[model samples]
Target: MTETDVVVIGGGATGVGVARDLAMRGVDVVLCERGGLGAGTTGRSHGLLHSGARYATADPEGAAECIRESRVLRDIAGEAVERTGGLFVQLPDDDPAAFDARIEACRDVGVPTETLSADAARETEPELASDVRRAFRVPDGVIYPSRLVAATAESARQHGADVRPNAPVTDIVVTEGTVTAVETDAERIEADHVVNAGGAWAGRIAELAGVEVPMAPTMGVMVAVDVGGVDSVVNRCRPPDDGDIVVPHVDRVVLGTTSTPVEDPEEFSTDEAAVEAMLSEGAAMVPAVADADVVDVYWGVRPLYAGDDGGRGRDASRGFQVHDHDVARLTTVTGGKLTTYRLMAEAVSDAVCERLGVTEPCRTADAELPAGDAEKLDALVEEFDAAGPADTDIVG
Candidate 1:
């Protein structure tokens, strides 16, 4: 039986972030994932690095956190983040009074936002529709979730952390009301501490440990376009609707998303209706997007841990919750956005270390992650490019 100081469930950003932090602190750590890293909600995100402008009006606290973490992530995870900035545009039907309130709220939270004339906005982004009434530019950007998660795992491994893919934790073994081990398909591993960063599966994992987590999973769908038609991240200056945002990645622009309630997180699918709605709504912001070709459609489920059936996922607090089940010797971290994943990990690692009597402070924030080096990244990208397209021909 293998043994470890900490066993992290889930391989998403939060899980890998915790693993890296603990391992860097000289504590034995192991991370197990049901599938590939970032295979869940992490990779399916909108890729926006919030400048805190989005939540400035709805939730000031959340907006402040986003701005603080956005800067930190930009510095540490340079390769994973692109400083494209962002713009909140007011369309013909949008209320100018609401836009004024949002700008004031952003200023209150110390977020730098500048109002621009419609022509100025169009000058910056040629694809933007001339019908735009007003625009506010903020310090928003883009992030590659897969790269971030991979970098975290690689950093943990470099510090002697063990990472196992396809290792779905089937059961949590507790004796005398204390967690002692976890069972997977292949074998059982003893764990002194367990951190459930399972994203959407967090509530289920907590239930296995005889605890309850109030996660209300909500499904969101995004469509990737082959062309990069926009210069920066464009958002509708009001409440989140079908496809009020267009996020630009390296070679393409992602039009997203739609929020709807779902019974099962794993079974949700992106259909034609969702795609059509995204295109229609997104077209209102940039009329050129109406003719863009969609490359792929994907869906993600946010683990919003508040309210009942008709809950508002985006409206729920973006802050995270860390539950320490002393009896079960386990901790479950839920909620929070992708922008603040590192902070979330630091909190979870600190709690785990305290529970296990490890006095090492978290070094994840300071320590440069594995892929922080540019040379290593170039090599990996070159290798992937050299592999070329896979051969589909196979003999049975």
Candidate 2:
């Protein structure tokens, strides 16, 4: 018999951010997740806080969003973001002529970049291959998922939000063409508004409300190496493809990923071919990546929107979309990646406020997560380190 102003479905990054934003705005909110926090696609990410350099050439809009959100995350969630920076290295096989376009695109999108000669690149990253044709440095960083999500959820709870994990939402009660309540395994909670932040499972939630949304869940494989091969995030200066990025985390290097379409988000398995592709392609950017001991092999599903762009696989847009089912008093936010979760949440929250006739402006960008003190930052870092591999499954 719980009653709230809003009930958000899904416990991934977007759901956590939505709950945090709404609660901060003085809205009664409850976030329900089927499994543990970040147990969906968010937990399986490569943990790269993008600088927007990768998509600058092909998708400037997406790039602009990334750069803006990247800076915001650094200020608001400093404890989870490591300012390692990033590099886009061009191989001999890559078209050197295209480097100019890449630089221009990045600059146009307000993403700062510094060109480096092959020798300078090697000096910065000694493990870089000698045959590197060109290199450009940008403001990329690493994100600790478990710590970030946990801190965000804690902040929401402190602000009076009810974050319920393991409470799978089974049904959406529609009364007189409007959503009246959300039925979960433990209890039925009445809500004035509902948001589908379920990531890959968002489409299913929409179905429960007799609405249809195109959610194309794409799977990507990531391999974790035991050795920390490079300090900065390394990416191939070419079109998005399999295994073109490598992330150096604490005591480990993550190589990823291969994008392929899947009918069911839950139905995905990693094969030897995909693992080999990541190791081999990742090594091309950082030579030491190939020899590093393989510690873990996992995959994550991306909640991509199937737009009329008609693009598939790596060609699909990375931007997000917010759909409002006015009659049902429901909102569904999907697509985008972990780097832009806050922005996605803000967009959806704005829609909710519009419908509820609340005029509170979004303060998520200005508000920092509860961890800004040095002692608190250190404590969070220690907690993240303690979680280890066993906790990785809960991140996505």
Candidate 3:
């Protein structure tokens, strides 16, 4: 039986990030995924590198975390990040009070903002709907999910972590309330500790260890369309709602999304009206999308913590929590945004290191990652088949 200091379940951003962080800190780690790297929530997101303005008013602490991590990513991830800047446009039909509150909250959360007049907003983004009354710019940008994941996995490997893709974890062996080993399709790994960084599948992973972790997953759809002249990420200035965001790529804008809780993250269905509303509501903000050619339609299930449920799935907190299962030596991390993935990994690695008696402070935020070279990054992505619907056009 092969042995590892720790076994990380899930090959998504958080799992790979944790592997990279732990490996960098001189810990032995083995990361396994059921599918290709990123193929989960990490690869399926709209790829927004949030400046935290989206949640500045509703979740100040989380918003603050996002802004801090946003800077870290922009600094370390290099070419993987596009500094497109973002706009929160207020329609004439929207609440002016909400716009003022957003400005106040952004200041409170340290999310920089600059208000732009209608003409100025139009000038900056010609494709912005003519009726867009006013807009504010923030430091939001875009992240290539597959590219970032490939770079992170590559970093983990360079740091001595074994990152295995398409190695589905089939079982977790618990002996007297302690996790002793993990069995994957590839092989059984004897591990001193196991981290369930399974994204939406965290609860199921916990179950394999005779532990329970409540997760309320919600499915949201993102539609990518080929359009021209849009250069910035555009978000509705009002409270979050369906089709409230339009994230730009080189040739398409990814319009998203609707949140509705599902019992099974793997078994949720999509709504046609919601898809139609994406084009309709997105068109309201950037009219050019009304006739844009559809490029792709994909969905991601949010790995929300059930304990934080506030009735409506949308009300569920975007904050994440690290759970130490009753089964000793098992930790489950759930609920977090891709923008703050590195921070989440640091937290999990810290927890694991403390248990292992390793005293290495996290340096992932400061040290630049590998895969800055587009060719190298794309090679790793192709090697792992990491391309997902979000960046299908870019890689492969």
Error of 2 at 342 (Å): 0.6
lDDT of 1 at 312: 59
TM-score of each: 0.92, 0.94, 0.98
> Which one wins on lDDT?
3
Best-fitting candidate, measured by TM-score?
A: 3
RMSD of each: 4.3, 2.8, 1.0
Candidate 2 lDDT for residue 304: 88
- Those runs of model 3 whose alpha carbons end farther than 4 Å from true positions after fitting are 308-312
Worst 10 residues of 1 by lDDT: 387-396
lDDT of each: 0.80, 0.84, 0.92
Compared to the true structure, candidate 3 yields what TM-score?
0.98
> C-alpha displacement of 389 in model 2, angstroms?
5.5
Worst 10 residues of 3 by lDDT: 308-317
lDDT of 1 at 121: 92
Candidate 2's residue-wise lDDT over 1-396, tens digit each?
Answer: 899999999988899899998998899999998977777787778888999999998889999999999999999986667889999999988888778889999999999999999999999988899899879999999887766776777778888999887789999999989999999988899999999998988889999998887877789988988766479999898888899988887677888889998878987666899999898998787777767889898788899877776566777778899998745689999799789999999999999988888888989898778765545644543432323332353233
